[model samples]
Target: MMIRIRSRDGLERVSVDNPAATVAELKFAIESQLRVPVHAQILSTNQNLLLAKAPGDLNKFTDMLDPNARVSALGISHGSIVFLAYEGERTVAGPAFHPSGSFGKKMTMDDLIAKQMRITRQENPHCELVSFDRDAANAFQHYVNESLAFAVKRGGFMYGTVSEEGKVEVDFIYEPPQQGTEDNLILLRDPEEEKFVEAIALGLQMRKVGFIFTQTISQDKKDYTMSNAEVLQAVELHAEGDLKEWVTAVVKLEVNEDGGADVHFEAFQMSDMCVRLFKEGWFETEVKGEIDPKLSRMKKDVVVGGKDVTSVDNDFFLVVVKIFDHQGPLATTFPVENRRIPVSPGALRSHLDRSRNLPFVKRISDFHLLLFLSKYLDVNSDVPALSGCVRAQATVPEGYQLLIESMASAC
Candidate 1:
């Protein structure tokens, strides 16, 4: 049986001859075949738990523990993709180089010049600038400000299209299912919601072009604008998207000298060199000391615009685009993803009754709350019925309203 193992270096496959091998045997196979030591190998079914020394201790679903337990019993089977987080460096066994042969010849002037050319940073971005739709930005920020109070982290995908002039316009935000803390955010995507978002993007003639995230206010004391973990996350997303114009935007509250907090928006795109290095596994995943912001910066001299490499720091970040806002096509609603909205069915009804002056669609304009209700409603009937009401700006039927209220009360 062959299983795919994914690590920072990318994916590889190893054959497990025994169908019911013990966890200890699996570790030995990885060490022998993959060259990752058993002591350093941290395996898990969940990507979020890949770094856990013993994932089972954090999640009941994780079974990569107990040296003697059968790998098959732990849900590892043929063709499965197991995530791996390992420490230390791995040595590859390959043919030795011979200077006498052309294949292993010493470097020449041309070789050095080509190497310099290949490793240079890309100065211009594919997209000129990224502009956020005012309504979309406001809708997302209002929820985070009012509910989350900027105490923790939050992230979402930006959906839009690039103009002919290379301008990227973000018109909507889709907040996936996630768990976030002050310094970390774990995306737990919902397949159903993703499908719905894809459909919406298709209708809007847009694509997922960027990622937006919030930095907790506590991080302001730090020197760097983006943390090491944040850099890792952004690079991974940028690489995964494979979009030349992919944007990474950060939203944070900067403290003024007067002690007032002002919201700041910063946008960046990972340089082409950064993406290539990440894919080539040039980065050291396990750092022994504090992360150096300059570690990823270019040390070699490469002339760009008549300036040496020192003129443009190789900090994995390229041009910073100016952000502008415009009207967009979405509204905020209840049950925001990742953040709990405290509302009972009674409370919902009370609010609706109090807002009788407003239209029905306006009263229930919280799309996040509608998504939560989607889980309980009949997909073929109730879900579409409610979606239609919102789309057409029509009043929801009394029966559907009663059903949602009852479901909310049951919760």
Candidate 2:
């Protein structure tokens, strides 16, 4: 069985053969797999433990204190996600950086640092409007609101189309492996899984259009719409995407006049200035508690509202985009990917059986379901062929249908 471990670093998995393994054994596995020393590590089922400010505060969480306690006794099992807090410097590997020659001219690193882009606010967003597929939006929100109870942050990549009028329509959301705390969201991206997603999107004639994330309940009381960390993450992705119309969507719970919690969605495009600053390495990435969450700290003073300052308000970097909804072509009923519960082969069989009365293409008109099949079938050929058939709503080849049914029965 595989158990997920989420820490400040990110989400990772460890395997154990026995379901009845002790908590001590689980810690040992974590130590070996994650490389945090057993003694320095503090494990808990409560996600709030990761928010502890001081070493003294950690004692309040006693959920996983007993080493001898059986993992199953504590309601942990395969696909269960546990929280981890550790003390000390744990090295996380980062991508290798290779600087390019300065436009074929020889310049010292010191000279390059003197020529960073000046920060500015953008009055208008490149994206005029952003629309969501009703079912896809509902599915993404329902899990975070009900199952997770808005206690932690969550994020996914929005996949769909961008129009010549600068309108962005999100048909689906592809969630990557990630760990979220009350204040932080760490996306542990998988290149292999993304390749499958890209292939399916290609067959469907769609592309990745935006990024979406949910804020925790704790963040509701904050003064700002987005924190500095959030601005950094959003802008980084915006820069990487290189899409002038790329949108960033936020999902949150707000209290209404009757004291009822309502799910609200807002869309924005990181201001052109924000993306430029992020790409040019002008914003400070390290977050400290002393710094205000509403403002982003900069490496040097930048002009904002005609004043030079070391920090800029996060709101200054966000340009609101209008929101709308539409009924997309694909269905979102199949179970979402990368949630706590594993999507088993039985799910495939059940889905096939439930939709048997419909056309073969209609039976498999789900992005997540296609994603599942993509893992087993050839990404370069078979995945695209199946997705192409679904896109056209054409009759599936008999041999392909037989192959799919055989896969479902193998469960």
Candidate 3:
């Protein structure tokens, strides 16, 4: 029997020979097979337990605290998923998979050719079109342009709806904590804050649709549409999103014919082959300084235009998607999150005061505002309740109004 274990690294399986294994036996097996020490392991049936940060936090989950408990009694059977947490890092061994010519066998030319990966342009993207809410789009670009001056990279996740026709409508952009340099963007994701964002989106009938990023001015001089680093980052996120229509949008400053700089937006979907290569661990994620920016390095040689090579042109992995703008239902008057300057309660008070003439529901319709309130309100109840009112354009309950006002005034 095999039990799947999900941790920060990814999912791996631990084999158990016994049908009725004890919790102690299961932990022993994990220790021997996965190379994680039994004393350092923290097991839980709840996936959220993996997000626990401290010893005090881990104590809250008592599902697998008793080692004497029987695996069957705990409802852990073959193929059941068990979440894991540990004190330090371990090199997680993935499932057994061998590349071509690795089985102590000599391969014929035809066999090698058959294994060769061919790069071709994807003519059409799965995402038919992507429409951004005018205000939401403006708010994002305005900040990067005005504040950052497009000198450093910045990124965010697009949240909105997808229509039956495969068209994506982006209503908001949630910027996670990140460090951006002139050439690289690193996202420092917050799982706790993301949970609140998810809850708010759930109540407002929306979801994460795509990824958005800005290119620095130094990158504008480059010839490639997207650098190798950018391609790797975008494809990884697209694969993780698991949405066929997921879009990757780039914001940059382009020199117009008038010799003035203009903010430009372009969208693309990673080609199917690109996502497959990323998931299959073919692309070399580590960006070497000597590597060309226009090409992506693969661990093995792949056929590019009938020639075997370790580097493939970045353009081959991109499928352009059409972009449009629309007036969405949500507002963008509230301060955004994950910015250099933290959002304060005074900003919330100012937002409420500025919109005093508007209805309570209208005042709280913005996604940023909802995100702010989500930090204080109950995600399971208060968040959905308030977002539901905004969705239906219904009246905000007096209780919620008072609570929000009190929170705004508390600071």
RMSD of each: 20.0, 25.4, 17.8
Each candidate's lDDT (Cα)? Answer: 0.68, 0.86, 0.88
User: Which candidate ranks first by lDDT, i.e. highest?
Assistant: 3
lDDT of 3 at 137: 96
Report the alpha-carbon TM-score of model 1 versus the true structure: 0.57
Evaluated at residue 10, the lDDT of candidate 3 is 49
User: Model 3: per-residue lDDT, tens digit, 1-411?
Assistant: 899886655456899999988888889999999888999888888866766777899988889888999888988999897877777766544334223424333334344333445678999998789999999999999999999999999999999999999999999999999999999999999999999998888888989999999999999999999999999999999999778999999999999999999999999999999999999889999999899999999988787874678999999999999999999989998999989888875998899889999998898999999998898889899888888898899999999999999887876
Best by TM-score: 3
177: Cα error in model 3, Å: 0.5
Candidate 1 stretches greater than 4 Å from native: 1-121, 142-151, 203-205, 287-289, 297-316, 341-366, 376-411
Clashes of each: 5, 0, 0
* lDDT of candidate model 1 versus the reference: 0.68
Clashing pairs in 2: none
| Cα TM-score per model | 0.57, 0.72, 0.74
CA shift at 194, candidate 3, in angstroms? 0.5
lDDT at position 286, candidate 2: 98
